[model samples]
Target: MPLHLADLVARSELHLSVVAAPDRLDRPVEAAHASELLRPGQWLQGGELLMTIGLLLPMTEEACRAYVQDCAAAGAGALVLGLGRELPYQEAPAPLIAAAEAAGLPLLTVPDEVPFIAVTKAVFAAKAAEQHRALERVFDAQRRLTAAAASGRGLTATLEAWVDATGIAAAVTDLLGRPIAAAGLDDLDPFGPAGLPPAVTELVHKVAGRGLRGSASSASGSLGSVEVQPLGANRLRGLLVLVGTLAPNDRMPASGLVSLLSLELERRHLADEPERRRRSALLGRLLTEGVSAEHAHDVLAVAGLASDTVRTVAVDPSGTSAEMAAEVAADLALAVPGGLVRVHDGLVEAVVGDNLDLIEILSRFASGAPAGIGPAVPPEAATGSLRQARALVAVSRALGHPAQTREAHSARLLLEFGDRRALRGYADAVLGPLDSADPTGDLVRTLATWLDTGGSWDETSRRLAVHRHTARNRIDKAMRLTGRNLDDGDDRFDLWLATRIRQEMKAPGT
Candidate 1:
């Protein structure tokens, strides 16, 4: 605790009497200075006790009032006067007492027997003790945090250690404001953007958008206090979020931890280079030979993308700065632990698990350039999604924003205003037999693609990743079931219209 006016007045030896503005005695006195100048405030800094013997001797009420107000304005914690018969005033003068009271400055009187040095020594000693304690706390926190970083237990361990050392909840988020590692977040989901508070997430984006030029930001919220600290030496690598207000003396410790966490992130990045390269290579192979190969499945398992449902994303690398593009690529690749991300040809692409909130990630990284998100499909059918993603990237550019596969088929959104039940009935009438015969959807998909390509077998087969013979067989099967003649323009038109309607009207995930 700091040395307050109350602390000195309570001591029996100093015999200091609080004669006015007693309520203000809680002000801390960091130092004590004795001056006889008519205006001593010019010589004093804040948090100092201004002691005087009334030597310049302003005996009038107005003169006394100006002196007292000056001291208060200069941040004098309190006014102390030495009382003695030999001095100008034996006791604290009545004019001075009234001035101090009106100014809301604590006024203390020193008896003739007490020396001014006693009070000055007391203030300096207490201030020294407080400073010593503050330094000790900072050193202790730094020691524990450093040890945790050295443990090589990863980012999570260091974060947990930080909370333990300082008792403040924290998390380290990637460039997208998604928590990569967290500690003491008992009330919130420890990972993903969905779990974090919207305000905090917005702040993360705001600071990250500024790069290294931005500084830390703090906000008051339901969680008491929240702070966002950007982490990086050359470019902004990540953010450190303190979920609660720090202790008054915690700034140094928090800064040290931010530096330590940055080192850990850089180290992890270097160490994971080979693994990232391997995932990138695997993604390339999947895009080429398709994901049906037994070896593809084995590699997918190792890459932590062992999911049946995955999405392909196309980000235009030309729109963003190299540094930002690199960060977003790294983030999207690790989005689902071993996600496959690679920069190929003229674009940056990634194979992400569909379970994550990919739209949010894409929105943050889009900048002015658009990204295309493919639909979720089985691993064996990943090539179809990649093709769709690349196609939509062109559509996204035209639309002036990031887009998804559904947006490319703009009919779905526009047709919703119509009588959906009525439209479904018409679609069912035209394609009901094909839907029933091909419950697996392969025939319906082939028929739609065949009609979409003006009855071209090779194009349909390539889009569906099937043999041209197989594609012709499925189209023929669909023609027989639907009673439609491809040779007739009217029949082809109705069949194509119905397939588009039926496919669009189907609820998502059906």
Candidate 2:
């Protein structure tokens, strides 16, 4: 048992006379420290039972009053005065006792025969015993936590051990503010006024700001108090809060247990982060690489992401590896309850519920790269939707606008007309005006006719009613007009696709 004022008083063998408010005696003497001076402005360390004999001051009433005022200002846990030498030993100086009472400092009268050293020794012995017991409890808690970790027990078991050791309730919440683990009192609500008492909330907010641990007590009448700490690497994980009701008269521990717990939680979280990232990466890779629907489903099941609906999206800036892709994919997966996987380089496939908000989910991925989102189809359509998303991405890249969406049918049009060859042509056509002055009229028309004839000079001549040589001359002239070569493999592919695309536009329903 920790030392209390009553214990100290009994041990000191002093006449137990309570002066002023006797109720203040209930406060614990948490530690053993003695101060004999009377400095008015000096701050008193909490829980210390201060002793004085009035030997340093005059015996006047004003001097006695000033001494009491100093004890109050210092917030001395209790004040013990030795009587009989200068002032009469039988009774406490009235003015001094009155001042001590007014200041709310617990005052104890010591007879001249009772040595102050005896009181200090008794307090010290009691504190030493308390420390030993606290150490035993801490060791027991640590052993249980180690066992739980080795056995792969969930967070709750570890929390339970801590609670049992400290006589406090422990709660672990995720970044989303949901409790993932808790132990001890079930009636402790975290959301209500009674649950997250004002002092605890203030302490949590303060700790959050500094990325450190903090604690606070409720108003004097509240049931219990709390301590809040940020746990995990980079403090990305949520908080761990410990709530407890301490015996009003028992000494509070001063051995930095709260700080130690914060370090332990952070260490564990850091150890787990790499493995979590690895698993997320594996899930992402399996989804993005065009895996069969059944295979993808198996992978999702393995990753604990089995869902009935999915949406596929293709991302650009293709150098992103599986790991980087996975992080983004995980964020998307968390945005919704269902599982998400990566299907290919820069492509993420997510199996989300029907009610999942598409805009918010996609927006998170968009922050990382230029992305083309396919329709939010069901899981059965994942493969097809992934292909559609790829097609949409191709169109976006070809048109130099990375995320625009045309009508629903636009994907099909781009799929049919925006192949790699078509993109080269579009690039040329768009770039042609920069290369030559009359590209729009001359180069575009000749290119169109040649494509209409299927790249054959004789056929093109027949369609245009010109000689083969003349048709060849027109084609060559058009390439020159666009400042490009028609015969080069890259140039030919570009011209052919661009010409065909332009002709298609002239046809109905372009």
Question: How displaced is residue 416 in candidate 1, in Å?
Answer: 23
Over 311-416, each residue of candidate 1 has an lDDT whose tens digit, in order, gives: 8888886756766666667766655565788777667788887787777667655566667889998776778888888887877776767778878664554354
lDDT of residue 451 for candidate 2 = 70
Q: lDDT of each prediction vs. the true structure? A: 0.80, 0.59
- Candidate 1 pairs with clashing backbones: none
TM-score of 1: 0.66
Q: Over the stretch 1-510, how does candidate 2's per-residue lDDT look in tens digits? A: 666787765653655556655778777786545555657336566677776676665656777778877766666677777666554355666777777777777888777676677777777778888888777765666666666544556566667666665677767654333456677857655445344555555555555444434434443224355656676443334567666664432223312333334455555655656655655565455545556667766765766666666666666645666666655565454445545544454565544545655554454344435566666665546657766767677665554444423423533355444564665566556546634655446446655677756687777777767788876776677666666775677766666556555555556875
Measured over all alpha carbons after superposition, the RMSD of each candidate to the real structure, in angstroms, is 11.0, 12.9
